[model samples]
Target chain A: MDGFIFSLIIGIFIGGVCGYLGTLMLSRKMALTAGPLGHLTLPGIALSLIYGFDVSLGAFPFVILGIFLIWLFETRTKLPMETLTAVVFASGVAIAFLFLPVEQAETALIGNITRVDIYGTIITSILCFLIFLIIRKNYHKMVLINISEDLAKASGINVRKNNLLYLFLIGILVSLGVRMVGGLLTAALFAIPAASSRNFSKNLFQYTNLSIFFGILSSLLGILIYKFTNLPAGPLIISVSSLIFLISVIFKR
Target chain B: MGKLKKQVLKMFAKDKKIILKVKNLTVKLDKEEIIKNLSFEVKEGQVLTILGPNGAGKTVLLKTLLGILPYNGKIEWKINVKIGYVPQRVPFVKQIPISVREFFLLKTTKEEAEKILDKIGFEKRILEKRLGDLSSGQFQRILVAWALVKNPNILLFDEPMTGIDVKGKETIYSLLLKLKKERNLTILLVTHDLNIVFKISDYVICLNKYCMCRGPPIKNVTPKTLQKLYGSKIKFYAHK
Candidate 1:
């Protein structure tokens, strides 16, 4: 496949899955959490740029480490997940700035979707599909936990295990998302489409399905705009999603 | 043996089947004791009401019994027990876009959820309404229906009538009684309503930080026990 086709395919897959996951995060009142987690992927992105490896591969370990620490501290210290994520991601960004080559900084920061080959596209698409399936299976349990931990526990759902799995999934998404939107705008990939969908959706089913629809729509539109305008795909994608959000707000009943 | 003594012996024999046993359950959050060395037991198919004022750790105790919180004691349930819990308030329910149907389906299949809703006399159309759009009373009923959909043998409720009006509260109370009778369910309810304590509960635990009085409400919950539990004067009106 051509660079344009490869980028388009990968972007669609990532955006759709991220948007679907975002519905759960938004419902749990943790929509903005992805922002800090996105930032946490920077050290890995910097390493990837330095070692000449795939950005997603380089981003994976750091985000996983950050997620593990956040999960550990949340359980041990009884601190909120967002609070721990903020602390961890700030440190990650600081470390990333220390070694990030100035020449490759732009690519590391805003991402270059055109750099991926067909192999990378296939791998990412498969990963997105797997993540989507996992989230779909646990969606109701996570929602129940958000509603009431006691209720979830009474229903024989393992709250702690589910929480850890959720954090791990977020880690995986952040790592994969950094390849498309870059570390800075990865959160927008998840948040904006879901937020827009919330305006028109009357129920969870519609909310999730609409979120995925908007995700793919914004991603494809952004890549097409980038093809003609030479603007960065990351910012373009976020901008398109943001435009949708604005229109949603205006048209909200 | 005398006739009364024989009846008492038979009653004791029937109560021998204990479904829950808690010994010295002490819960501490942030190093501050919430429930201190409390002990209680629940018989199968009985209504055990937990009564106390605000900040009295009623919610905490219920959470501990559900194994949601760390507690330093033995909380043993009968083997193969299924519990359904209705929390005091789902504070974020208003912000969520989940429809009532989705909420019910979280714990059960659509057919089971519909059956429970029907049994509760709820309009089937209400299933399409978003959780955020329901009145507090309606939400409370939905919570109850959600609990029942799982066919739990024990139901635990924390201040289930927090935002319900007087008439709504009566409806919920009667519904609870009806459900218990129909399903042979054991209930562990935490509430502030003295009338409910006296009227429906087979056993009452007047708790503050500790168990103050625990027994049949008609025999054990005196005016003095209420004052001690609440740390203030209480106007007692027995509900027959």
Candidate 2:
């Protein structure tokens, strides 16, 4: 596939996954945590540098581990979930700086979606679709789980297991999107579309459809701009998405 | 200690007719006793209104039964019933606008949700309006509809009438009574509205740190019983 087409496809997959995860984060009131999950990818990439492994593969474990640590600190400590996420994210940047050369670190920060392989993009698309299906099948249970932990248990939701599954899926999405979009702007991929879609749609199905549409449109526009203007892909995509959001808000009333 | 009671649960269970049975039940929140050694059972086609003063642990007791809080005791109840629960409060955010139908549809089918709204005497147009724009009474009614959509064999409501006006409360009570008769549902509702409870409840369980009084309403309810349940400072007036 051509570079622009490949980038747009990957963008749709990444954006869809991000938008899905973003809905949960928003509902759980844990949107801020997306920052740390995104930023923490730095250490994962840096660790790949030290260990001689695929940066994406190496970063996956660290991101998952970071999720676990985040969950632990969040549950056991008095600090808010957002504070823990920020601390971990900052620490990840520090750790990455200590290990990676300045040149690679800069590339990691800015992100280059053009570098993602066609095979990798296809794999992400399949995985994102699978995750979406699982969530759709269990929509009732997911809402029950989010509304009240206790009620979920009473209703036989297996709250702990479902929560772990959700976070793990999110971690995988974060690592994958980070590899393609760059860590700094990857979280925007998750939050912006989901937030905008929520304002427009009420039911979960409608919300999911609108979110996916917005995500794909933002990516296509971003990639188009990058192809024509040589601007960075991540920021371009996020900017377009943000503009859509602004327009939606303006006409919402 | 009260003997462990295994009464027949309502439609949710195989035996049918028993809602809940507790044996030596005790609940503590942050090391403070909320419900102390309480036991009771609610039968099918009946409403059991739990009456208590402020901070009397009525809410705590309901939460414990719903598996929200940890407690020490034996609770033998039907596990098969699809339980419908309405909490004391619904988090309202001005930014997130949800419609009455959208809210109920979160847990139930569209046809059933529409039926519930219709049964509540609301105009079909209410389904399309945003929840943020709803009056307090309308919001509570929608919450009830949400709970009703589940068609629960046993329904547990915690102050479902709070924030509702008198007319709204009357409509809710009448609707609940109709539902109870039609579905033979076992309802354990916690409310400070003793008059309404006295009128509709088949049984009343008055609690103050423990099960102070429990039996068929009026025939077993008295001011002395209220004093025992809530101390002499608090009193229970007869349902006129």
Candidate 3:
């Protein structure tokens, strides 16, 4: 496949996974956390760039650590996720700057599709599919946790363990997703499709399906636009995502 | 003490109607004690209400029994007794596109949800409606229906009537009465409303940081217990 086509296929797969994860964040009202988490990838990318490793592999551990800290703070302090996200992300970024060289910041912030290969694409596809199966199976349990931990516990669900598991799942999505959308706009990949679909869905299933559809569409279109225009693929994808959201809002109104 | 209680619980092993028993329950949060030494027993097919003021740790106590919070106590339950909980408020964000039917399907099958909603005085039409669109009373009924879909033998409610008005409370309580009679279910509810205590509770637990008084409302509830709970002089009236 040509570079353009290869990039397009990879972008759609990544965006779809992001969209799926975004629905949970939006429903759980933790979408904003994704923004800082995306930025927090800087240190990992910096280390990987310095060491000649893949960006995703470099960024993985820190994302997992960030999620762990957020989950711990939330349960212990009973503070809202929004507040915890801010604290965690701010500290994460501050530390990231320590390791990240200034010159490579732009390259790290705007993802380059030329970096993706057949091996990376195959691996990402497998990971995304595996994540999908897991999320589908646990959708109800996670929703129960989202609504009320008390209710989930009352129904004999393991609230704490499942909650931590969910954070880990989102953590994986962030590590994989930041490579395609770039650290700056990685979160938009999760939030935009979900926000758009929320305006159009009549039920939960429709909401999820529509979000995924939009995810694939925005990703593919964004890559096409970037290839022709020679613009940054990350911002191009976010623009398309935003346009879809605006259209949905109009339809909802 | 824990060992003795476990032995006693094993001794009461065959008494299936004793749905829940908590002995010397204690809960602490953020290194501060929220629930002090508390003990309570709930029998099958009884309405037990935990009455207390704000910050009296009623929520903390209910959560402790449900195992949602770590507690230093023995909470023994009759074997295989399923529980359903209806929180005073759930975090929906009021924007997620979810129907009542879809929400119920989260934990139960469609047929189960239909029957539960029917029992909760909702018509089949309401199932397709968005949860965000439901009226306060309707939403409250749906909360009950959501729990019923779990097919629980016991229901634990934490401030189930928090945002409901007086008229709405009446409708909800009536539904509770009807369900209790029809299903022979056990109920443990936490509330700050004394009037509700007199009207519906078979047993009242006046709690402030811990259980102040616990017994049949008529025999054990008095002006002194009310004062101890609310720290305010109040007139007493029972639903005749």
Model 3, span A1-253: residue lDDT tens: 7667667777888888788878888988888877777777878888888888888887788887777677678778999877887887677678777877888776578767657778888888888888888888887888777777777777778876887777787778888887887777778989999999999988888988999999999999998899889898888899999999999989983
Clashes of 2: 3
Error of 2 at A216 (Å): 1.3
TM-score of each: 0.92, 0.87, 0.92
**Candidates ranked by TM-score:** 3, 1, 2
Per-prediction DockQ: 0.65, 0.32, 0.67
Please tell me how candidate 1 rates in CAPRI terms: medium
Error of 1 at B197 (Å): 1.1
Error of 2 at A204 (Å): 3.6
Q: Write the per-residue lDDT of candidate 2 for residues B111-150, one digit (tens) a residue.
A: 8888888887788889887776788778777766777766
Candidate 2, pairs of clashing residues: B8-B18, B9-B17, B9-B18
How well is each residue in A13-128 modelled by candidate 2, as lDDT tens digits?
A: 77876776677667667666666777788887776656655656766887887887898897789697768877888887787788777767754675677766677678778887
Worst 10 residues of 2 chain B by lDDT: B1-10
Clash counts for all predictions: 0, 3, 0
User: lDDT order of candidates, best first?
Assistant: 1, 3, 2
Q: Give candidate 3's TM-score.
A: 0.92
